[model samples]
Target: MIPPAFRDPVHDSQSAFRRLLKALSRPGTPVSLTGPAQPPAPMGGPLAAIALTLADADCPIWLDPALSTEPVRRYLHFHTNAPQIADPKAAAIALIGDAGRLPGLNEFHPGEAAYPDRSTTLILQLPALTGGPSVRLSGPGIETTASLAPRGLPGWFWQAWHENAARYPLGVDIFLTDDRIVIGLPRSTKVEAP
Candidate 1:
């Protein structure tokens, strides 16, 4: 049976949304998500909370093959009432369970000049949130530069991120999560290897 959603949808969702906004605003800073529901296997708590908070009937979600499981689909559908789309370009949110096998950064919609906000937002679930190769981040919302060391990402991720960042207002945004912590990486942020 599918687990129940948050005990109080209004309050819980609002709290989660605030945390997400703060994370996105201060890119690379970690935020903790609290909710009543615990997601099934392969879906971290923070990621599940994000899906419930951000996704709705208007937003369609795309799942990587590794995350396209019955329990996950059921949970998201029952809680968010969001459609599941097959094409990555059509997804408002893309969930990547295994960053090691992540699709090319360009595969998803980068949005258009006229409507840059339509680009997909990725939620990548990693094994750990710290202690890996660090990347220097600088841009809006950053004073000078911030360093982040997200573990379990593919080696080519930084290079692809550089290319994606070059797209300016047209690139997708990302939220990296483990079990409880979440860090945002908006497309506007410049990522450099350290």
Candidate 2:
């Protein structure tokens, strides 16, 4: 059921779509959006806008264990006509809670040599965004170290990302959303510890 606040997606879609598009267009940047995003049972909170902006018939999604319930999956399938996949490599979108449990940086398809655009996008249900020990992201789209409070970019990820960077035009792009805001990890952004 659409939330009471979002009875009108036709209108809401415009703003939500703009925020998502802008976030994707600029790497190492953050965007804030709010409104009728009442996610379904067990799927918890961020489900609403996530369903609205990311799902579609052409994209395949891989749900984390926390989001693997039948009701949640069914709701997404019914609404978006998006297929669900078991392998992250096959998914165009991967929904997860802990970025830690996801397959090592090498396992998922980080796009290909030529068609680097064919990479997976990961959406995480973050516990919170904080300041300590965080990294600063900056590059082409970022004006400065886009001081990001990303919680779980595991140690190995930094190492592997260096490898992905080696692939240059071929690497995965990341979009992270918390309860209040969403941020980007564009393939072009560089990460350094704060």
Candidate 3:
């Protein structure tokens, strides 16, 4: 059966949105989320909650191979009325189930200089938020610098992130999620590995 969406759609979505904003505003800091009632497989509560909170009829989503299952498709379509696009560049949001095998960050839309807000927002599902190689983050919203070690990302993830950040106001934003935690990595954040 298709799992339910938010219990109280209005309130739940509002709460989810607030948490998302908090995460993005303070990059690298983990935020808790009260996800959907019972999200489908491959998509745990945190990813499902972010999807529900951000995606809508006007936002087209791009699902990676791991999360492009029929059930996930149906659930998202039914609940959000958001269309799933095949081309990553055309999607407003990209849902990635496997961070270790993620496509090149540039494969997705990196908004043009004049319209940076049009860039894709990636929501990636990882095994855990820690236990991997740690990186230092410094940018707006951060007091000084924050350290993060999200497990399951590829070896070149940080390098790619640096490249993405170099583009200044023209790169994709990211939301990293595990079971119940989420952390944002806006393009403005600089990632340095030691």
CA RMSD per model (angstroms): 1.0, 2.6, 0.7
Error of 3 at 130 (Å): 0.5
* 1 against 3, candidate with superior lDDT: 3
The C-alpha stretches of model 1 lying farther than 4 A from their native spots are: none
Tens digit of per-residue lDDT, candidate 2, span 9-54: 6777677778777886776566786645556654434435665567
TM-score of 3: 0.98
Tens-digit per-residue lDDT, 1-194, candidate 1:
99877788899889999999999999999889775556877887788888888999999999999889999999999988999999999999999999889999899999999999999999999999898899999999899999999999999999999988999999999999988899999999999987
Tell how far residue 77 is off in model 1, in angstroms.
1.0
Model 1 lDDT on a 0 to 1 scale: 0.91
Error of 2 at 147 (Å): 1.6
Better of 2 and 3 by TM-score: 3
**Each model's TM-score?**
0.97, 0.85, 0.98
* Best candidate according to lDDT: 3
Which numbered prediction scores highest in TM-score against the true structure?
Answer: 3
